[model samples]
Target: MGTRLQNKVAIITGSTSGIGRGCAELFAEEGAHVIVNDDGSRKGLGEEVVEHIKASGGSASFFRADVFQSEDLRKLIEYATETYGRLDILMNNAYKGHATSVLEQEEADWDMVFNSSVKAAFLGCKYALPAMIKAGAGSIINTASIHGLLGGLRHSAYASAKAAIVNLTRQMAVDYGKYGIRVNSICPGRIVTEGKIEFLKKYPEEVRRQQAVYPLRRPGTMREAASAALFLASEDASFVTGHALVVDGGLTAQLPDSVAEPLEEGLGLFRTE
Candidate 1:
């Protein structure tokens, strides 16, 4: 195993599957004792993740915490500290909400999005800060999206929440750098998570169109996004904080009209599935 994060304790929220799972597993491989978490919505998935890590000779355990619940968020931070005696990394990577325009969305949709995306990261920082402050160092990785930088149609709630997270990360970095705590965010564009892989399989044309816009000519992988989180969490980024790291495979670097050239026709027509 790599020693990039040797002896560190990492709490990754909503880590049962997708990019969260990728971060959890990769963190473990890098010698961090990972606290794999889920909101209990995935039932046995968290344990399954733990088993996989253990089989690979990495240290890991399962913890269930719904980021939407403040108490649950508090306890998650507590669990990591009580079990490991120190908190070195807090990866706020869970997001749940409706995918629609604000004009056509429900009030609860906005609430859920902000609560899951923005508020959860806030609470994670709230509860984890003390232990980090006590220990004199920590790293927090908030998973944002390219939508946070360039708003996407039909992703109003999710996009807005992500935008909030990006700024929140910046604000926290300014507030916490005095204690050696690094706050950074990763903004991935079209990461092909499990769900997206299925979608890509079904909508090959859409995949092609999405790739055509990206200089890399493909959607990113969960591992690619996880690597960004790993970099932020490790000493490799010791002097980096309050930065939104984009892992969008060169999609966001393009001009606005260039990006819209191929996607304009399909805007608001793509389904979440």
Candidate 2:
């Protein structure tokens, strides 16, 4: 195993599946003691992830907790410190949202999206900060999205929450730098998570059309996203903080004309899915 994160203790929220799962595995492979956190709904999957890490000769443990609950988040951080004796990293990667424009979205939808995406990050930071301060240094990685940098239809709550997270990363960085804690975020575009893979299988033509717009001409994988998190958590990024590293395969760097004209007819194809 790599020693990039050797002897570090990392708490990754919502790490049972998708990008969170990828981060858990990669952090373990890098010799970090991983605390894989997920909600009770995915207890079995969380256990499976822990087992997978162990089989690969990595250290990992699963903790079921709801990110939206302040008490749960507090306990999650406590669990990491009590079990590992130090908290070196915290990746607030949990998110949940549905596709709906502001005008069409219900109050309940807004609450759910904000609580899961924005408020949960807030709570994670709130509880993890003291432990990190005690450790003398720490890395905090928030998983924002390209949607946070750019607007999209039918993603009002999700986009707004992500945008808030990006700024929150910056604000936290400024506040915690004195304490040796680095705060940053990752803005991913079209990552190939398990759910996205399923969607692509059902819409092969749409995939080709979407790929045509990106400079890389394809979607990114969860491993790629995990690598970015790994970088931010490692000493390689010692000088980096309060930065939203865009891992979008150059999607955000392109001019609107490249995709806008074609997207006029294919706008429906571009979604948070």
Candidate 3:
């Protein structure tokens, strides 16, 4: 019921859950006719998302497709333009990665992670760009991660794929700026998605450690990340492109030991109270 994206058409992959789901709902609420894409395994969840959108007075439909496959991605783009008459935004938010170091990771695991996290974005842009070129204007948002900007303890494959996406966004922006297509990436920090919630339940101590590092003293939410994507997708960011907007609660802006507690009592560098 917002006019921010009134009459626009958007396709968001991996939109059945997590941050992608947040983008799907928020984009639809902002007046875009959304194409909610997810893999066939999550068809029921995808349909549920569409039903929720409709019930809330928004326009949306579910399209089940494996984003890693070029053929499937091609159909996804076609389905959007054919259904909505034009494509205005494309969000390549699908992601899958293993928690393994470079030396410990299997070849198959590396391939799968790259195909899911990096290749999917490449294909989404590849197929969506032509339709956007015809429309004379478009927005493409890629879901990179804070891990892409900084190193992670045991996330070699995920970090590398996200870094690739960040650069890919820049490359696409440079290549297609003349066509009026804007490309950008969102680098989110630790967000409290369902999976993350479960992980935190198992390791409550980890939660405290993570919160201490973030300047906000807490993890972010999917809605917060979605808002960042919305800004990049809307005309508010018309002049923005090739930017990796960091949404990490200022975690990367501080020094590694800035959040450390004082060794002696009443000697903290920065008082929390």
Candidate 4:
């Protein structure tokens, strides 16, 4: 029953699933009118998410645009302004290119990764700023990752993109603070989503072993990350900007010091079910 974002107009890109979808749904639940922006290639999941929101008595609409296209990004902002008369939040979250390793990653793959990931954040802010300036205030949340601050075995491009986003968040906040626009980034650790779940299904043993090292002994849920976004987007975080809020179940904060151990009975990162 929290109306923290009552009447705000928000656009969340890559909202077909994962963190973006979580943000869109939670924003709606918090009384923000949401634009469910998707790249339109997912298997009807994006539109279905919009339907789920409306079905829950939350306000939402869908827009399909490839974030790599400048024109599409422009139209996305336009759609928000046209549909809602003002845009209060812009979430840059679409990305492609998950390579096995930096050495194995191709040049074209590197280009595509930055183009869709970091470039979208850069460009989305470039375009969304005007509308937000006109509205007098807005929030922009970018999806960073634990890899941004730390690193992973085979995520050079993704890690770099996220790292850049964290810095971009700071730059935007500093540049636009006078204009009442707040920009921040979220560096989520492992969040269990349909995509990750599918990946896990393909490598069950590795996933289980990977899950063991975390202090939480489990991955985060999408809703948990979305709730953090809700706080940043709402008035509750009015004084917060240019920060990367890590939602990693204390993994980054504590687990690195602990000996890598298999899940022991009663000793876990999550609450015992």
Give all candidate RMSDs, comma-separated.
3.6, 3.3, 2.8, 2.7
Candidate 1 segments whose C-alpha is farther than 4 A from its true place: 257-273
Least accurate 10 contiguous residues by lDDT in model 2: 264-273
lDDT of 3 by residue, 1-273 (tens): 788898889999999999999999999999999999888795488889999999999999999899778999999999988887899999999987575898898888898889997899998888899989988999999999998999989898889889999999999999999999999999999999878999988977667666667788778999999999999999999999999999999989987667664222222233333
- Could you give candidate 2's per-residue lDDT for residues 1-273 as a string of tens digits? 999999999999989888999999999999999999888795488889999999999999999899878899989988988888889999999987675897898888888889997899999999999988887899999999999999988998889889999999999999999999999999999888988888888977768677667777678999999999999999999999999999999999989887766566663544434
Provide the overall lDDT of each model, using Cα atoms, as 2-decimal numbers: 0.90, 0.90, 0.89, 0.86
Candidate 4 per-residue lDDT, tens place, 55-84, comes to: 988998988889999999999999989888
Kindly list the per-residue Cα lDDT of model 1 for residues 164-260, writing each as its tens digit.
9999999999999999999999999888888888887887787767666777767789899999999999999999999999998898788879877
Q: What's model 4's TM-score?
A: 0.92
Clashing pairs in 2: none
